[model samples]
Target: MTQPQDPQRSWPRFQTRKPRILLLTSQFFLLGEIRAACERLGVEHVLLDLQAKEMGLDDFVRTILGALTTFRPDFVLTVNHLGVDREGVLLQILEALDLPLASWFVDNPHLILPAYPRTHADKTLLFTWDADNIEPLRDMGYPNAEWLPLGTDVHRFAPGASGRPDWDADVSFVGNSMVAKVLGRYKAAAPGDELAAKIREIADAFGPADEPSAARFMLGRFPELRDAFLELESPARMLAFETLLTWQSTLDYRLDCVKRLLPFRPMIVGDKGWKDLLAEEENWRLHPEVSYYDELPGLYPRSKVNFNCTSLQMKGAVNQRVFDVPACGAFLITDRRRQMDRLFEPGSEVVTYADPEQIPELVERYLADPAARKAVAEAAQKRVLAEHTYDHRLEALMRTMRLTFEPAAQS
Candidate 1:
């Protein structure tokens, strides 16, 4: 009989033994998914919850170092650099110890990644959810920038799940009303009158354009704004302005998408921001936020059609809803994203609308055709189960890490 091939010969191992990972936990929704993925892969992990205790720099360093010494993990991982400090102490320590650190960004890296000072560490591997960001990240001098899209937990978000009747609806959207919060911040920290007016004007002109186009339009219209943004005087001012611009665009786009579905009487599950934003819309039903682990699993599968409006911050990337909705065996009508075509078969496994004008029509068509909706949902679920689960993601991540850090581990 022929000897069986070693699995390690096909796939590189991170270490001689099962790789131990130190997971820096935070309030981010993906924390649980990562933990579960590690469990399913039989990888040993230690969770260091940052929010559980308040720690100064010294305490933080001590705690992390203690964990490093005790757990002796091959790597330290976190979602979007949640537990990392702005001073880069954690990164410096990891670098000194020659430990591999992986930070997977599910959100816009431009906004969050810059906050970390030691982003260019050689041992640091930065994974972005958006493939469009890979070039930008490389341009930013990140040596190990990779495109790693988000995945769903198939077991948690599956079909025929029992959920509260209140959560069930013909059309449902689960996201935040970010406009109010973002605009409120901008208003409080408004630049001078001239700059503020220019900001408003540029924002008004930034309708329905992709990120690059919007940025170019704003720059073309108001060149001084770019100069002012780049000015070193009060960096916080520029950051706040950029945040406002991004959020304003997102809020406007999301509101427009939701408004298109007003005819469908969509149920919006999110924060009070939605209630305040659509206060006059009688057709929209707003529910309070649901816990990701406890409630969202049931809610996603229960809804007939789960809607996803990708945030403007993520232009080419699909949001978590794109994967989660399908994994739940529910039909998803998400705004068309360039990356969606690569992830799912458009109109078959998943549905997409390029314009807000098409949203209402698509919703109507899907609502009227239950068989079509069911077929697409089932197909999407199959695709998700087969290829887009966290297990697959974890395996890919490990492979990348091994190739980057331990190429010799491969036979």
Candidate 2:
């Protein structure tokens, strides 16, 4: 998790006991993993429902306070700042109560955090999946930003039999085509004709570049976008524009990378967008999206090779598939990222493509040699179990939190 490769670095620990955490629950997938991690570590937790968007202010406040009183938590945990509202209601309550908040971000923070208030930046510890986000988050007023990369619930993704024989394929890639997502965000932003044209040109240029944040990359490459940026007026509008471009660039980039799979006749398990993108292409099989917790575990084992191309926002970081596919004891062929060397041993533990052109060759070679794929999958699973489990990540999070916010009780 870019958690340092050296053995000599001093690490923190909970001095008194494992702290109770009040979990702000959502339908987000990571909450389940975090809860499992807490259970594994013997940490106490209680949930506060934040799933309803239309919940009144009275209910929101009452629910939060009730949880705090009952749970008596040492900290409050959230995913992607879900309960930490942009209007600062949650932030106000937490700061008033002196509860430290831990928000683990798995998405592009540039597109998410700008909407949230920064009242308790110091107390709101940010654990980002992307290491590239650390400095940017720090600049964005979260001084306590840290990197805690994605990991798998090994038991959930463990190697098992594939119940469906039809799942067996030379290659399979499970991900959104981003066609609807890009278009949705773009329409929501609703830029004027001239601004929309400028935005399109910027997204077109940004897709192929090796950059992290779309806003920074756009302004750095073309200063003129800054004027169009200011024309958006509201902070929310600016955020919407940046988010739309990010998804648009990702759609373009991912399509180019995934197109390489066409000749291999890959099985694409995703939304209708795949059909929208590759209409009537007879080469590949396009199956509707599968449930991550249930179907993916089975699908990975049957497929000879699993392909992954990350979102453009994560320029130098690995995504969940890099961890999950291996944990399933299946071979994955992913695009190379800067932080990859920190996670896997590259050629031995994992196979990577520095260019999309290399994908077909890698897929062909790996598929032809089952023994080689098996060896690499075994190696990757071993590494994942050892250093990249949810438990390991929670251990690191607890250690860091204690060092920064919690203090040991003196006898």
Q: Pick the candidate with the highest TM-score.
A: 2
Superposed model 2: Cα runs more than 4 Å off: 1-15, 408-411
Give TM-scores for every candidate, taking all chains together and pairing residue i with residue i.
Answer: 0.89, 0.93
In model 2, the worst 10-residue window by lDDT is 1-10
Residue-by-residue lDDT tens digits, candidate 1, 26-138 = 56548888898999889899998888466776777778777877777778889888888777777767765667898899888887765678543678899999998887777
Tens-place lDDT per residue, model 2, 79-173, is 88877766787777777666689988888888888887798787789999999889988988789999988888898999884548878888999
Root-mean-square deviation of every model: 6.8, 6.6
